[model samples]
Target: MIETIVFDVGETITRDDRYWASWADWLGAPRHSLSALVGAVVARGQDNAEALRLLRPGIDIDAEYQAREAAGRGEALDEADLYADVRPALTALRELGVRVIIAGNQTSRAGELLRDLDLPADLVVTSGEWHVAKPQPQFFERVREVARAAPSATVYVGDHPANDIFPAKAAGLRTAHIRRGPWGHLWADDPEVAAAADWRIDSLFQLASIAKG
Candidate 1:
């Protein structure tokens, strides 16, 4: 039985439209241009942040983030940013006695913002808080530790194949590949992603059934 359901924030629980749009505005670049670059970077298996660097070579992303914040524009999330199904799906899982957690490759401020939303989750955390990011075994180890369950009893759900499905499967957890965002749709039909994911779903509502199983 799946006792815990851990989620990736970007393009899973949340749509990244505003997140990337904000970056485009900050860099004074056309939003469509940056979005296209992000998709291209993902297609090449490059980090999505490479899109920003392509916009401004040698750009210090971390410093730019700090500067954006100082200038009154930083990471922002609200109820509107959430997927339409997020609330209902999470609430349903919790009602079913399934432990729901939100842990993703997000910043500490993003974590705080997620917690502030008060979603029906046992915990909300981020790579910035844990000092580790995904595609790394240590990240999933932290996930298992925080889940307080055997790896097999937990399910990791996300849209990214390399960062979400592959590593989580390697960690011995059941994996759900959600086809929602760029990476999700782009790699959804890949032979390896299909093989790695224990479940392939297009909607968060599908998780209710996975939890029950």
Candidate 2:
């Protein structure tokens, strides 16, 4: 039985993949290429701050950099609304006896976002909090520790293949790739993504059926 479900806040829970577009414009790289680049950076053990520094000049990394700064200072910015139906989906999952945990690189931004949505999650595992992001095995390992979960009984639902899918698979957790928000195109084109994910759902609501199995 699945006792815990790990979720990625941005894109997966919140409709905020717009950061990718900002990233692309800031880095002057193609949006898709930036997706792969961020994956490669994480794979190489580089921090997001260092990655931003290495990126070319004239790119406005301000929004992202500012958000991180705000998080560090414990300030909340109203970027936009968290994804619609996120509260309902989370409430439904909890009703099914599934403890929901957030696993992402978001600093305190995710927690603030969830709070703003008025939805309560059981646990939040963040790279900023843990000093690592997904696709790196340590991210899931840290999450498992925080959630007190056994890998086989937990499922990670996220949108990124390199970070979300591959690492969760390696961590012995089932992976559900939800493609609809930002990185929707990345999910469509990433070759390694399909093989890494155990299940693909277009929406969070679909997890109810998949988890039941």
Candidate 3:
């Protein structure tokens, strides 16, 4: 039986529209242009941040992040950013006695914001806190360490196939490919993604049944 359900932050639990919009504003680029660039890079299998680099050649992303924070316009999150199904789905899963966790590649500040939202989760963590991001074996290792459960009993759900499905599956955890974000919709129909994911869900609401089964 699945004893734990771990979630990816962006697109899984929250919409990333605000995230990219903020970045576009920071870079003084049109929001639509940056959004299009993100999709383009993702389609080419390049990092989405590459869009920023494309906009400003040789840009130091970390330094820019710090500058944005100092300017009081850095990463921001709130209840409004959450998906409609997030609360109901996570609550339903937890009510079923399944441990729910939110883990993803996000900044430490994003982690703080997520906690502030007071979502119904056992723990909220990020790659920034662990100093390790997904698609890395160590990241999943850390996840297993925190979960304190057998890999087989844990489920990692996310919208990214490369970062979430493939790596988590390789780490011995069951993987669920959630079709909700840019990456989610783009790769939802890929054969490799379908093969890697133990479950393909259109909404978080489906997790309760998966946890029960």
Candidate 4:
């Protein structure tokens, strides 16, 4: 049985419109322009960070993120940023006696912001705090450690195929491919990646019905 259900934050549990809007400010591009660029990057199966760098050379992602946080504007996900189904789905999973964790690649202060929001996540960890990012085996191992559950008995849910599903599966965690967001939607039709997921969900609302501890 899966005793823990860990979710990817941005675009998985968090809708992330605010973050992109910030990116728009940094690029001095309209929000729609940034969104379109992001879509292009996703459609090409490219890394989001790398694509941003390619678009704006010498862009310091971390520095900008810190500056924004210092100004109390860095957290991309606000109360309004969460998907409508996130809280309900998370609460339902918690009621099943499963440990629910929200872990993702985010600024160092992301956990602090999320805590204030008080989402149902039992634990929230960020790559900034953990000193590692996803698609790296160590990242998932840290999550495994924090979860206090065997990797095989844990479920890793996320919208990214290369980052979340593949790496989590490699780490012996069952993977759920959520078919939303750029990464998820762009790759949803890919035969190989789609075939690999232990679970495929259209929405977090379906999580309670499918992921049983």
Candidate 5:
């Protein structure tokens, strides 16, 4: 039985098109260009930050982001940025007495940002805090260790099959693919990605059904 459900923050539990679009605008790249670049990077089975930097070179990411946060634009996302299905699904799973975790490979402060949002997470962690990103055995190991969960008893939900699904599967956990965001929908038909997931659902509402299974 799945006793723990770990989630990827962006796209899976949150919709972030506007989030990336705003950054693209701020960085003087066309919104679609940024989006396409991200898709291209993921298509190559690579992380998207390198694509962002490639699209807009020589900009100090940390400095620019810090300055923006200092000026109150906020650090990437707020509680309002979450997808509509997130709250109800998380609430449903929690009501089933399942342990829920929010884990993301995101900006250095993403873990803190998620924790501040009053979201339904018993634990929130990030690659920034752990100094390790997904697709690495250690990252899943961290999740497994902290949740006090054996991988077999865990179900990881994410949008990116390259980074989330395959790795989690290798770590011995089941994976659920949610097709709502860039990478999710972008690689929906990808052969490897299509085969990686044990479950596929278009919305978080489906998670409730899995909670009872």
Candidate 6:
């Protein structure tokens, strides 16, 4: 019996493409034509500095989003706010008696986003709070500790293989990789993660079905 469902906010439960599109639009770039250089910067382990030089350019990435929100042009700039149709799935999970938790590299903005969407989560474990990123086993171990999740009773659902699947696997948790997204590494694609995943799904709606069995 799966007791807890851990979610990766960006591409797993939320629609990250729309958020990327918003960023491209804010930068005055064609949404489709904007070079996916963000991926390269992330792969190369460059801080937001390189990404700013190429994409944001003299704009404070965080401040710009806040400004947009202040000007009423943005609702919530955080992943929890920008992603779509997540609350419903979370509600469904709760209805099905699954304890839901969020694990991501987000600021405290996650709490506001969840409150805005009115989603019910037992806890949210973020990278900022943990001081570690995924693909590092310590991250998952910390989340497991907070959620008190048994290895056999919990699963991690995320879009990236390294950040989402690898660390979770190393931490002895089952993993579900969400397909179809612009995650940093093409190597994190679902087919690749599926080769090692205990389960796989294209969307959060499919999670309950996958977990029930």
The whole-model lDDT of each prediction reads 0.95, 0.69, 0.93, 0.84, 0.83, 0.69
TM-scores of all candidate predictions against the true structure? 0.98, 0.71, 0.98, 0.92, 0.89, 0.74
How would you encode candidate 6's per-residue C-alpha lDDT over 77-102 as one tens digit per residue?
Answer: 44444445577778788888888998
RMSD of each: 0.7, 5.4, 0.7, 1.8, 2.1, 4.1
Summarize candidate 1's per-residue lDDT along 1-213 as a digit string, tens digits: 999999999999999989899999999999999999998999998889999999889999999999999998988889999999999999999999999999999999999999999999999999999999998999999999998888998999999998999999999999999999999999999999999999999999999998899
Tens-place lDDT digits, model 5, residues 65-160 = 887688776556676789888878888889998899998787667677787787877888888888998878999898888767778779999998
TM-score of 1: 0.98
Candidate 3, residues 1-213, lDDT tens digits: the string is 999999999899999899999999998999999999989988987878899998889999999999999999988888889999999999999899999999999999999999999999999999999999988999999999887679999999999988899999999999999988789999999999999999999999999999999
- Runs in model 3 deviating more than 4 A are none
How well does candidate 3 match the true structure in TM-score terms?
0.98
lDDT of model number 5: 0.83
Which digits, one per residue and each the tens of the lDDT, describe model 2 over residues 67-138? 546656333324364666676777888889888887787875555655565555887556776777666777
Backbone clash numbers for all candidates listed: 0, 0, 0, 0, 0, 0
Model 5 worst lDDT window (10 residues): 71-80
Candidate 4 lDDT, 1-213, residue by residue in tens: 878899998889888667787877866778887788788888877887765675678989878777777886655557788888988989998998889999998867787888788999889889989999998999988989988888887889999988898899889898889988888887876776777788888998777766553
Clashes of 1: 0
Q: Candidate 4, residue 116: CA error in Å?
A: 1.3
